[model samples]
Target: MGMNEHDQTKYIFAQSIKDLMAKQPLDKITVTDIVKHSGMTRQTFYRYFQDKYDLVNWYFEKLADKSFRQIGNSSTLKEGLVKKFTFLLNDQIFFMQAFQSKDYNNVENYDYQCILEFYKQIIHNKIGDIPEDIMFLLKMYCHGSITMTVEWAIRGMKESPEMIADLLIDALPPKLEDLLSDLR
Candidate 1:
Protein backbone atom coordinates (compact mmCIF):
# COMPACT_ATOMS: atom_id res chain seq x y z
CA MET A 1 0.00 0.00 0.00
CA GLY A 2 1.08 3.53 -0.72
CA MET A 3 1.97 5.72 2.24
CA ASN A 4 -0.31 8.64 2.90
CA GLU A 5 1.05 12.16 2.98
CA HIS A 6 1.19 12.06 6.77
CA ASP A 7 3.31 8.90 6.82
CA GLN A 8 5.53 10.31 4.08
CA THR A 9 6.07 13.44 6.12
CA LYS A 10 6.86 11.39 9.21
CA TYR A 11 9.40 9.37 7.22
CA ILE A 12 11.05 12.57 6.06
CA PHE A 13 11.52 13.67 9.66
CA ALA A 14 12.57 10.15 10.71
CA GLN A 15 15.29 10.02 8.06
CA SER A 16 16.50 13.51 8.94
CA ILE A 17 16.90 12.56 12.61
CA LYS A 18 18.52 9.22 11.71
CA ASP A 19 21.10 10.97 9.53
CA LEU A 20 21.77 13.54 12.24
CA MET A 21 21.98 10.76 14.88
CA ALA A 22 24.86 9.22 12.91
CA LYS A 23 26.78 12.48 13.27
CA GLN A 24 25.92 13.21 16.93
CA PRO A 25 24.07 11.98 20.01
CA LEU A 26 20.28 12.23 20.19
CA ASP A 27 20.43 14.87 22.94
CA LYS A 28 22.61 17.02 20.70
CA ILE A 29 20.13 17.00 17.85
CA THR A 30 17.48 19.74 17.76
CA VAL A 31 14.10 20.30 16.11
CA THR A 32 15.59 23.03 13.93
CA ASP A 33 18.20 20.63 12.62
CA ILE A 34 15.61 18.00 11.84
CA VAL A 35 13.30 20.43 10.05
CA LYS A 36 16.17 22.06 8.18
CA HIS A 37 17.57 18.68 7.18
CA SER A 38 14.16 17.71 5.85
CA GLY A 39 13.62 21.12 4.25
CA MET A 40 10.40 21.43 6.26
CA THR A 41 9.13 24.11 8.61
CA ARG A 42 9.29 24.01 12.41
CA GLN A 43 5.48 24.21 12.42
CA THR A 44 5.30 21.13 10.21
CA PHE A 45 7.66 19.18 12.41
CA TYR A 46 5.72 20.08 15.56
CA ARG A 47 2.49 19.13 13.84
CA TYR A 48 3.83 15.63 13.39
CA PHE A 49 5.85 15.11 16.58
CA GLN A 50 6.04 16.83 19.97
CA ASP A 51 9.84 16.57 20.00
CA LYS A 52 12.74 14.60 18.61
CA TYR A 53 12.30 11.99 21.35
CA ASP A 54 8.70 11.45 20.34
CA LEU A 55 9.89 10.91 16.79
CA VAL A 56 12.44 8.44 18.04
CA ASN A 57 9.73 6.58 19.91
CA TRP A 58 7.59 6.64 16.80
CA TYR A 59 10.47 5.21 14.79
CA PHE A 60 10.90 2.45 17.33
CA GLU A 61 7.17 1.77 17.32
CA LYS A 62 7.18 1.61 13.54
CA LEU A 63 9.97 -0.91 13.72
CA ALA A 64 8.08 -2.87 16.38
CA ASP A 65 4.94 -2.93 14.27
CA LYS A 66 6.89 -4.38 11.38
CA SER A 67 8.77 -6.84 13.55
CA PHE A 68 5.99 -7.96 15.89
CA ARG A 69 3.04 -7.98 13.49
CA GLN A 70 4.52 -11.04 11.86
CA ILE A 71 4.35 -13.02 15.12
CA GLY A 72 1.36 -15.17 14.33
CA ASN A 73 0.42 -18.80 13.77
CA SER A 74 3.28 -19.30 11.35
CA SER A 75 6.02 -17.90 13.61
CA THR A 76 7.07 -18.84 17.14
CA LEU A 77 7.39 -16.12 19.81
CA LYS A 78 11.07 -16.96 20.26
CA GLU A 79 11.62 -16.44 16.55
CA GLY A 80 9.83 -13.10 16.80
CA LEU A 81 12.12 -12.13 19.68
CA VAL A 82 15.19 -13.14 17.69
CA LYS A 83 13.98 -10.84 14.92
CA LYS A 84 13.55 -8.04 17.47
CA PHE A 85 16.96 -8.50 19.06
CA THR A 86 18.63 -8.77 15.67
CA PHE A 87 16.89 -5.60 14.53
CA LEU A 88 18.13 -3.78 17.64
CA LEU A 89 21.62 -5.25 17.28
CA ASN A 90 21.78 -4.12 13.67
CA ASP A 91 20.98 -0.55 14.77
CA GLN A 92 23.01 -0.72 17.95
CA ILE A 93 24.32 2.81 17.81
CA PHE A 94 20.94 4.44 17.25
CA PHE A 95 19.24 2.28 19.87
CA MET A 96 22.05 2.67 22.38
CA GLN A 97 21.58 6.41 22.24
CA ALA A 98 17.80 6.12 22.34
CA PHE A 99 17.95 3.95 25.45
CA GLN A 100 20.15 6.47 27.29
CA SER A 101 17.31 8.88 27.92
CA LYS A 102 15.86 8.86 31.45
CA ASP A 103 12.86 10.91 30.46
CA TYR A 104 9.30 9.79 31.32
CA ASN A 105 8.66 8.85 27.69
CA ASN A 106 11.89 7.02 27.18
CA VAL A 107 12.24 4.16 24.74
CA GLU A 108 12.24 1.62 27.56
CA ASN A 109 8.81 2.74 28.69
CA TYR A 110 7.50 2.54 25.15
CA ASP A 111 8.93 -0.92 24.75
CA TYR A 112 7.29 -2.11 27.96
CA GLN A 113 3.89 -0.87 26.83
CA CYS A 114 4.26 -2.52 23.45
CA ILE A 115 5.41 -5.83 24.86
CA LEU A 116 2.71 -5.87 27.54
CA GLU A 117 0.03 -5.24 24.96
CA PHE A 118 1.50 -7.86 22.65
CA TYR A 119 1.42 -10.58 25.29
CA LYS A 120 -1.92 -9.44 26.66
CA GLN A 121 -3.40 -9.95 23.21
CA ILE A 122 -1.93 -13.43 23.03
CA ILE A 123 -3.48 -14.33 26.38
CA HIS A 124 -6.79 -12.83 25.39
CA ASN A 125 -6.83 -14.95 22.28
CA LYS A 126 -5.95 -18.08 24.21
CA ILE A 127 -8.32 -17.71 27.17
CA GLY A 128 -10.31 -14.46 27.00
CA ASP A 129 -9.83 -11.43 29.30
CA ILE A 130 -7.07 -11.76 31.86
CA PRO A 131 -7.80 -11.34 35.57
CA GLU A 132 -6.36 -8.33 37.41
CA ASP A 133 -3.85 -10.38 39.40
CA ILE A 134 -2.65 -12.19 36.30
CA MET A 135 -2.45 -8.88 34.44
CA PHE A 136 -0.26 -7.57 37.25
CA LEU A 137 2.10 -10.50 36.80
CA LEU A 138 2.17 -9.91 33.07
CA LYS A 139 3.03 -6.26 33.65
CA MET A 140 5.88 -7.28 35.91
CA TYR A 141 7.15 -9.67 33.30
CA CYS A 142 7.10 -6.99 30.60
CA HIS A 143 8.75 -4.44 32.87
CA GLY A 144 11.59 -6.81 33.73
CA SER A 145 11.99 -7.78 30.10
CA ILE A 146 12.19 -4.19 28.96
CA THR A 147 14.68 -3.36 31.72
CA MET A 148 16.87 -6.31 30.75
CA THR A 149 16.62 -5.33 27.09
CA VAL A 150 17.68 -1.76 27.83
CA GLU A 151 20.59 -3.02 29.85
CA TRP A 152 21.52 -5.41 27.09
CA ALA A 153 21.59 -2.57 24.58
CA ILE A 154 23.45 -0.24 26.93
CA ARG A 155 26.04 -2.96 27.59
CA GLY A 156 26.86 -2.97 23.86
CA MET A 157 24.86 -6.13 23.34
CA LYS A 158 27.75 -8.51 24.02
CA GLU A 159 25.37 -11.44 23.97
CA SER A 160 24.26 -12.92 20.67
CA PRO A 161 20.71 -12.03 19.55
CA GLU A 162 19.66 -15.66 19.55
CA MET A 163 21.07 -16.17 23.02
CA ILE A 164 19.30 -13.11 24.38
CA ALA A 165 16.02 -14.14 22.83
CA ASP A 166 16.30 -17.60 24.29
CA LEU A 167 17.19 -16.23 27.71
CA LEU A 168 14.26 -13.81 27.67
CA ILE A 169 11.75 -16.47 26.74
CA ASP A 170 13.11 -18.76 29.39
CA ALA A 171 12.63 -16.01 31.97
CA LEU A 172 8.86 -15.84 31.46
CA PRO A 173 6.74 -16.19 34.58
CA PRO A 174 5.18 -19.62 35.08
CA LYS A 175 1.57 -18.57 34.40
CA LEU A 176 2.52 -16.69 31.25
CA GLU A 177 4.87 -19.53 30.40
CA ASP A 178 2.02 -21.99 30.52
CA LEU A 179 -0.29 -19.67 28.55
CA LEU A 180 2.24 -19.18 25.78
CA SER A 181 3.59 -22.72 25.78
CA ASP A 182 2.01 -23.48 22.43
CA LEU A 183 3.72 -20.49 20.84
CA ARG A 184 7.13 -21.71 21.97
Candidate 2:
Protein backbone atom coordinates (compact mmCIF):
# COMPACT_ATOMS: atom_id res chain seq x y z
CA MET A 1 0.00 0.00 0.00
CA GLY A 2 3.06 2.28 0.25
CA MET A 3 3.26 2.50 -3.54
CA ASN A 4 4.75 5.54 -5.22
CA GLU A 5 2.88 7.26 -8.00
CA HIS A 6 4.44 5.06 -10.70
CA ASP A 7 3.69 1.84 -8.85
CA GLN A 8 0.16 2.94 -8.00
CA THR A 9 -0.51 3.85 -11.62
CA LYS A 10 0.65 0.46 -12.81
CA TYR A 11 -1.51 -1.28 -10.25
CA ILE A 12 -4.51 0.82 -11.19
CA PHE A 13 -3.97 0.07 -14.89
CA ALA A 14 -3.64 -3.66 -14.28
CA GLN A 15 -6.69 -3.80 -12.02
CA SER A 16 -8.66 -1.79 -14.55
CA ILE A 17 -7.83 -4.28 -17.27
CA LYS A 18 -8.79 -7.20 -15.05
CA ASP A 19 -12.12 -5.58 -14.19
CA LEU A 20 -12.83 -4.80 -17.85
CA MET A 21 -11.91 -8.35 -18.84
CA ALA A 22 -14.56 -9.74 -16.53
CA LYS A 23 -17.19 -7.87 -18.56
CA GLN A 24 -15.80 -8.29 -22.08
CA PRO A 25 -13.19 -10.02 -24.20
CA LEU A 26 -9.63 -8.69 -24.53
CA ASP A 27 -10.13 -7.78 -28.17
CA LYS A 28 -13.08 -5.63 -27.25
CA ILE A 29 -11.28 -3.78 -24.47
CA THR A 30 -9.46 -0.80 -25.93
CA VAL A 31 -6.81 1.57 -24.69
CA THR A 32 -9.53 4.14 -24.22
CA ASP A 33 -11.57 1.78 -22.09
CA ILE A 34 -8.51 0.96 -19.99
CA VAL A 35 -7.61 4.60 -19.49
CA LYS A 36 -11.19 5.34 -18.59
CA HIS A 37 -11.41 2.57 -16.02
CA SER A 38 -8.01 3.43 -14.55
CA GLY A 39 -8.85 7.14 -14.35
CA MET A 40 -5.67 7.92 -16.21
CA THR A 41 -4.96 9.83 -19.38
CA ARG A 42 -4.03 8.12 -22.67
CA GLN A 43 -0.42 9.17 -22.23
CA THR A 44 -0.31 7.47 -18.86
CA PHE A 45 -1.41 4.10 -20.20
CA TYR A 46 1.12 4.36 -23.04
CA ARG A 47 3.78 5.33 -20.52
CA TYR A 48 3.41 2.00 -18.71
CA PHE A 49 2.50 -0.36 -21.59
CA GLN A 50 2.82 -0.65 -25.32
CA ASP A 51 -0.73 -1.98 -25.58
CA LYS A 52 -3.13 -4.30 -23.84
CA TYR A 53 -1.13 -7.28 -25.07
CA ASP A 54 1.98 -5.86 -23.42
CA LEU A 55 0.05 -5.41 -20.21
CA VAL A 56 -1.13 -9.01 -20.46
CA ASN A 57 2.43 -10.22 -20.93
CA TRP A 58 3.56 -8.16 -17.93
CA TYR A 59 0.74 -9.67 -15.88
CA PHE A 60 1.79 -13.20 -16.85
CA GLU A 61 5.43 -12.41 -16.10
CA LYS A 62 4.47 -11.23 -12.62
CA LEU A 63 2.54 -14.45 -12.03
CA ALA A 64 5.47 -16.48 -13.31
CA ASP A 65 7.85 -14.77 -10.86
CA LYS A 66 5.57 -15.58 -7.94
CA SER A 67 4.85 -19.11 -9.14
CA PHE A 68 8.53 -19.87 -9.72
CA ARG A 69 9.36 -19.02 -6.13
CA GLN A 70 6.51 -21.17 -4.86
CA ILE A 71 7.55 -24.11 -7.03
CA GLY A 72 11.23 -23.78 -6.20
CA ASN A 73 10.61 -23.68 -2.48
CA SER A 74 7.98 -26.40 -2.35
CA SER A 75 8.66 -29.75 -0.67
CA THR A 76 6.94 -31.59 -3.51
CA LEU A 77 6.23 -30.72 -7.13
CA LYS A 78 2.56 -31.48 -6.64
CA GLU A 79 2.46 -29.05 -3.77
CA GLY A 80 4.05 -26.47 -6.01
CA LEU A 81 1.57 -27.02 -8.84
CA VAL A 82 -1.34 -26.78 -6.46
CA LYS A 83 0.04 -23.52 -5.15
CA LYS A 84 0.50 -22.21 -8.67
CA PHE A 85 -3.00 -23.20 -9.78
CA THR A 86 -4.47 -21.70 -6.64
CA PHE A 87 -2.79 -18.45 -7.58
CA LEU A 88 -4.32 -18.65 -11.05
CA LEU A 89 -7.80 -19.38 -9.74
CA ASN A 90 -7.64 -16.18 -7.71
CA ASP A 91 -7.66 -14.35 -11.03
CA GLN A 92 -9.66 -16.92 -12.95
CA ILE A 93 -11.90 -14.35 -14.58
CA PHE A 94 -8.98 -12.56 -16.22
CA PHE A 95 -7.32 -15.86 -17.15
CA MET A 96 -10.51 -17.20 -18.70
CA GLN A 97 -11.00 -14.05 -20.71
CA ALA A 98 -7.40 -14.19 -21.90
CA PHE A 99 -7.77 -17.84 -22.89
CA GLN A 100 -11.05 -17.20 -24.65
CA SER A 101 -9.24 -14.90 -27.01
CA LYS A 102 -7.82 -16.38 -30.26
CA ASP A 103 -4.48 -14.79 -29.41
CA TYR A 104 -2.55 -17.36 -27.34
CA ASN A 105 -1.52 -20.48 -29.19
CA ASN A 106 0.28 -22.94 -26.88
CA VAL A 107 3.64 -22.11 -28.45
CA GLU A 108 3.15 -18.35 -28.54
CA ASN A 109 1.58 -18.05 -25.12
CA TYR A 110 3.39 -16.35 -22.24
CA ASP A 111 1.73 -18.42 -19.52
CA TYR A 112 2.51 -21.65 -21.34
CA GLN A 113 6.21 -20.86 -21.67
CA CYS A 114 6.32 -19.70 -18.05
CA ILE A 115 4.90 -23.05 -16.86
CA LEU A 116 7.34 -24.95 -19.06
CA GLU A 117 10.29 -23.11 -17.56
CA PHE A 118 8.95 -23.63 -14.06
CA TYR A 119 8.74 -27.40 -14.60
CA LYS A 120 12.20 -27.48 -16.18
CA GLN A 121 13.63 -25.97 -13.01
CA ILE A 122 11.73 -28.50 -10.93
CA ILE A 123 13.08 -31.40 -13.01
CA HIS A 124 16.60 -30.01 -12.89
CA ASN A 125 16.57 -29.94 -9.10
CA LYS A 126 14.98 -33.38 -8.64
CA ILE A 127 17.71 -35.25 -10.51
CA GLY A 128 21.17 -35.91 -9.00
CA ASP A 129 23.03 -36.50 -12.24
CA ILE A 130 22.10 -34.33 -15.19
CA PRO A 131 22.54 -35.40 -18.77
CA GLU A 132 21.84 -33.43 -21.93
CA ASP A 133 19.46 -36.13 -23.17
CA ILE A 134 17.61 -36.15 -19.87
CA MET A 135 17.24 -32.38 -19.92
CA PHE A 136 15.57 -32.60 -23.32
CA LEU A 137 13.28 -35.30 -21.98
CA LEU A 138 12.36 -33.10 -19.05
CA LYS A 139 11.68 -30.18 -21.39
CA MET A 140 9.51 -32.46 -23.51
CA TYR A 141 7.47 -33.46 -20.50
CA CYS A 142 7.21 -29.84 -19.38
CA HIS A 143 5.96 -28.79 -22.79
CA GLY A 144 3.32 -31.49 -22.82
CA SER A 145 2.21 -30.66 -19.30
CA ILE A 146 1.90 -26.96 -20.09
CA THR A 147 -0.07 -27.71 -23.24
CA MET A 148 -2.51 -29.84 -21.28
CA THR A 149 -2.82 -27.13 -18.64
CA VAL A 150 -3.77 -24.62 -21.28
CA GLU A 151 -6.50 -26.94 -22.47
CA TRP A 152 -7.79 -27.38 -18.93
CA ALA A 153 -7.73 -23.63 -18.28
CA ILE A 154 -9.59 -22.87 -21.52
CA ARG A 155 -12.36 -25.23 -20.43
CA GLY A 156 -13.27 -22.76 -17.61
CA MET A 157 -11.31 -24.72 -15.02
CA LYS A 158 -14.38 -26.62 -13.80
CA GLU A 159 -12.18 -28.74 -11.56
CA SER A 160 -10.61 -27.46 -8.38
CA PRO A 161 -6.96 -26.39 -8.52
CA GLU A 162 -5.98 -29.22 -6.20
CA MET A 163 -7.80 -31.73 -8.34
CA ILE A 164 -6.08 -30.44 -11.47
CA ALA A 165 -2.70 -30.53 -9.75
CA ASP A 166 -3.26 -34.12 -8.52
CA LEU A 167 -4.40 -35.16 -11.98
CA LEU A 168 -1.24 -33.69 -13.49
CA ILE A 169 0.92 -35.37 -10.87
CA ASP A 170 -0.81 -38.68 -11.59
CA ALA A 171 0.01 -38.32 -15.29
CA LEU A 172 3.74 -38.20 -14.66
CA PRO A 173 5.89 -41.26 -15.36
CA PRO A 174 5.63 -43.92 -12.65
CA LYS A 175 8.03 -43.40 -9.73
CA LEU A 176 8.88 -39.86 -10.89
CA GLU A 177 6.95 -38.35 -8.01
CA ASP A 178 8.58 -40.82 -5.64
CA LEU A 179 11.98 -39.88 -7.01
CA LEU A 180 11.29 -36.16 -6.58
CA SER A 181 9.78 -36.64 -3.15
CA ASP A 182 12.84 -38.63 -2.15
CA LEU A 183 15.10 -35.79 -3.22
CA ARG A 184 13.16 -33.44 -0.95
Candidate 3:
Protein backbone atom coordinates (compact mmCIF):
# COMPACT_ATOMS: atom_id res chain seq x y z
CA MET A 1 0.00 0.00 0.00
CA GLY A 2 1.08 3.51 -0.66
CA MET A 3 1.96 5.78 2.25
CA ASN A 4 -0.53 8.53 2.98
CA GLU A 5 0.65 12.11 3.24
CA HIS A 6 0.33 12.15 7.01
CA ASP A 7 2.21 8.90 7.32
CA GLN A 8 4.96 10.15 5.08
CA THR A 9 5.28 13.35 7.01
CA LYS A 10 5.43 11.49 10.31
CA TYR A 11 8.04 9.15 8.91
CA ILE A 12 10.18 12.06 7.88
CA PHE A 13 9.76 13.77 11.20
CA ALA A 14 10.78 10.64 13.13
CA GLN A 15 13.80 10.10 10.91
CA SER A 16 14.80 13.71 11.24
CA ILE A 17 14.67 13.44 14.99
CA LYS A 18 16.69 10.25 14.92
CA ASP A 19 19.35 11.88 12.78
CA LEU A 20 19.51 14.95 14.96
CA MET A 21 19.69 12.84 18.09
CA ALA A 22 22.68 10.96 16.75
CA LYS A 23 24.61 14.20 16.39
CA GLN A 24 23.60 16.08 19.55
CA PRO A 25 21.46 16.10 22.66
CA LEU A 26 17.69 16.10 22.27
CA ASP A 27 17.38 19.40 24.15
CA LYS A 28 19.49 21.05 21.46
CA ILE A 29 17.18 19.89 18.70
CA THR A 30 14.55 22.32 17.42
CA VAL A 31 11.57 22.14 15.11
CA THR A 32 13.49 24.14 12.55
CA ASP A 33 16.29 21.61 12.66
CA ILE A 34 13.81 18.81 12.07
CA VAL A 35 12.15 20.66 9.22
CA LYS A 36 15.46 21.50 7.66
CA HIS A 37 16.72 17.94 7.99
CA SER A 38 13.45 16.45 6.83
CA GLY A 39 13.18 18.85 3.86
CA MET A 40 9.69 19.80 4.96
CA THR A 41 8.22 23.11 5.96
CA ARG A 42 7.49 24.18 9.55
CA GLN A 43 3.78 24.06 8.71
CA THR A 44 4.04 20.46 7.67
CA PHE A 45 5.88 19.52 10.85
CA TYR A 46 3.35 21.34 13.04
CA ARG A 47 0.46 19.77 11.19
CA TYR A 48 1.49 16.40 12.55
CA PHE A 49 3.25 17.33 15.78
CA GLN A 50 2.67 19.90 18.49
CA ASP A 51 6.36 20.08 19.41
CA LYS A 52 9.55 18.05 19.77
CA TYR A 53 8.18 16.33 22.85
CA ASP A 54 5.11 15.25 20.96
CA LEU A 55 7.30 13.75 18.29
CA VAL A 56 9.43 12.06 20.92
CA ASN A 57 6.32 10.62 22.55
CA TRP A 58 5.00 9.50 19.21
CA TYR A 59 8.29 7.85 18.35
CA PHE A 60 8.29 5.86 21.56
CA GLU A 61 4.58 5.02 21.14
CA LYS A 62 5.21 3.57 17.72
CA LEU A 63 8.11 1.53 19.09
CA ALA A 64 5.86 0.35 21.91
CA ASP A 65 3.17 -0.73 19.46
CA LYS A 66 5.70 -2.73 17.49
CA SER A 67 7.08 -4.28 20.65
CA PHE A 68 3.58 -5.25 21.75
CA ARG A 69 2.90 -6.91 18.43
CA GLN A 70 6.10 -8.92 18.80
CA ILE A 71 5.09 -9.95 22.28
CA GLY A 72 1.66 -11.01 21.11
CA ASN A 73 3.14 -13.59 18.77
CA SER A 74 5.55 -15.18 21.21
CA SER A 75 4.62 -18.51 22.78
CA THR A 76 6.03 -17.75 26.22
CA LEU A 77 5.75 -14.70 28.43
CA LYS A 78 9.42 -14.65 29.38
CA GLU A 79 10.48 -14.84 25.78
CA GLY A 80 7.94 -12.23 24.81
CA LEU A 81 8.96 -9.84 27.53
CA VAL A 82 12.64 -10.29 26.75
CA LYS A 83 12.03 -9.73 23.06
CA LYS A 84 10.00 -6.59 23.76
CA PHE A 85 12.63 -5.21 26.10
CA THR A 86 15.46 -5.89 23.70
CA PHE A 87 13.55 -4.34 20.85
CA LEU A 88 12.68 -1.22 22.79
CA LEU A 89 16.15 -0.78 24.18
CA ASN A 90 17.94 -1.27 20.89
CA ASP A 91 15.53 0.52 18.59
CA GLN A 92 15.11 3.64 20.70
CA ILE A 93 18.68 4.21 21.77
CA PHE A 94 18.32 7.96 21.46
CA PHE A 95 15.51 7.93 23.98
CA MET A 96 17.74 5.93 26.28
CA GLN A 97 20.47 8.54 25.86
CA ALA A 98 18.01 11.28 26.69
CA PHE A 99 16.95 9.43 29.78
CA GLN A 100 20.58 9.08 30.78
CA SER A 101 21.13 12.77 30.26
CA LYS A 102 18.14 13.51 32.47
CA ASP A 103 16.55 15.53 29.71
CA TYR A 104 13.35 13.48 29.41
CA ASN A 105 11.01 12.05 32.02
CA ASN A 106 8.38 10.39 29.87
CA VAL A 107 10.33 7.39 28.50
CA GLU A 108 9.84 5.33 31.61
CA ASN A 109 6.13 6.11 31.76
CA TYR A 110 5.72 5.36 28.08
CA ASP A 111 7.58 2.04 28.36
CA TYR A 112 5.74 1.09 31.53
CA GLN A 113 2.34 1.72 29.98
CA CYS A 114 3.25 -0.25 26.88
CA ILE A 115 4.52 -3.17 28.93
CA LEU A 116 1.45 -3.13 31.17
CA GLU A 117 -0.86 -3.12 28.15
CA PHE A 118 1.04 -6.07 26.71
CA TYR A 119 0.90 -7.94 30.01
CA LYS A 120 -2.80 -7.24 30.36
CA GLN A 121 -3.39 -8.79 26.97
CA ILE A 122 -1.28 -11.83 27.81
CA ILE A 123 -3.06 -12.35 31.14
CA HIS A 124 -6.45 -11.86 29.59
CA ASN A 125 -5.65 -14.39 26.89
CA LYS A 126 -3.94 -17.14 28.87
CA ILE A 127 -5.56 -16.96 32.32
CA GLY A 128 -8.80 -15.28 31.22
CA ASP A 129 -9.08 -13.70 34.64
CA ILE A 130 -7.10 -10.92 36.26
CA PRO A 131 -7.40 -9.61 39.77
CA GLU A 132 -7.13 -5.86 40.27
CA ASP A 133 -4.36 -6.33 42.79
CA ILE A 134 -2.35 -8.46 40.38
CA MET A 135 -2.80 -5.89 37.66
CA PHE A 136 -1.54 -3.20 39.98
CA LEU A 137 1.46 -5.30 40.90
CA LEU A 138 2.17 -5.92 37.25
CA LYS A 139 2.17 -2.18 36.63
CA MET A 140 4.62 -1.70 39.46
CA TYR A 141 6.83 -4.43 38.10
CA CYS A 142 6.79 -2.90 34.65
CA HIS A 143 7.73 0.54 35.90
CA GLY A 144 10.56 -0.81 38.00
CA SER A 145 11.86 -3.05 35.22
CA ILE A 146 11.70 -0.35 32.59
CA THR A 147 13.49 2.09 34.84
CA MET A 148 16.22 -0.43 35.59
CA THR A 149 16.57 -1.40 31.95
CA VAL A 150 17.00 2.22 30.92
CA GLU A 151 19.58 2.67 33.64
CA TRP A 152 21.28 -0.54 32.60
CA ALA A 153 21.52 0.56 29.00
CA ILE A 154 22.74 3.96 30.03
CA ARG A 155 25.37 2.23 32.12
CA GLY A 156 26.40 0.37 28.96
CA MET A 157 24.18 -2.73 29.12
CA LYS A 158 26.65 -4.21 31.64
CA GLU A 159 24.80 -7.51 31.64
CA SER A 160 23.58 -9.36 28.62
CA PRO A 161 19.90 -9.17 27.74
CA GLU A 162 19.51 -12.82 28.70
CA MET A 163 20.86 -12.16 32.16
CA ILE A 164 18.58 -9.18 32.54
CA ALA A 165 15.66 -11.27 31.32
CA ASP A 166 16.38 -13.92 33.91
CA LEU A 167 16.52 -11.28 36.60
CA LEU A 168 13.17 -9.91 35.46
CA ILE A 169 11.59 -13.35 35.31
CA ASP A 170 12.77 -14.14 38.79
CA ALA A 171 11.32 -10.86 39.97
CA LEU A 172 7.82 -11.66 38.71
CA PRO A 173 5.02 -12.60 41.09
CA PRO A 174 4.50 -16.27 41.96
CA LYS A 175 1.17 -16.49 40.19
CA LEU A 176 2.74 -15.17 37.00
CA GLU A 177 5.60 -17.58 37.45
CA ASP A 178 3.17 -20.50 37.51
CA LEU A 179 1.34 -19.17 34.48
CA LEU A 180 4.51 -18.61 32.43
CA SER A 181 5.98 -21.97 33.31
CA ASP A 182 2.75 -23.65 32.35
CA LEU A 183 2.77 -21.82 29.02
CA ARG A 184 6.29 -23.06 28.40
The Cα local distance difference test for each model comes to 0.86, 0.73, 0.74
- Score residue 95 of candidate 1 by CA lDDT: 88
TM-score of each: 0.89, 0.81, 0.82
Best by TM-score: 1
lDDT string, candidate 3, 1-184, tens digits: 7879887779889988888888887777889999999999999888888888778878777776667566666777667767766775686557655555444445656666766776776677776888887777877778888878778767766676667888888888886666554332
Off by over 4 Å in 1: none
lDDT of 2 by residue, 6-101 (tens): 867887888999999989988789999999988999998899898888887777667766674567677777778888788777778877777666
Clashes by residue pair, model 3: none
Report the poorest 10 consecutive residues by lDDT, candidate 2.
175-184
For all the candidates, what are their Cα RMSDs to the real structure? 1.9, 3.0, 2.7
**Which candidate leads in lDDT?**
1
The global Cα lDDT (0 to 1) of model 3 is 0.74
C-alpha displacement of 13 in model 2, angstroms?
A: 0.9
Would you list the rank order by TM-score, best first? 1, 3, 2
Give me the displacement of residue 119 in model 3, in angstroms: 1.2
Candidate 2, residue 168: Cα displacement in angstroms equals 0.8
TM-score of 3: 0.82
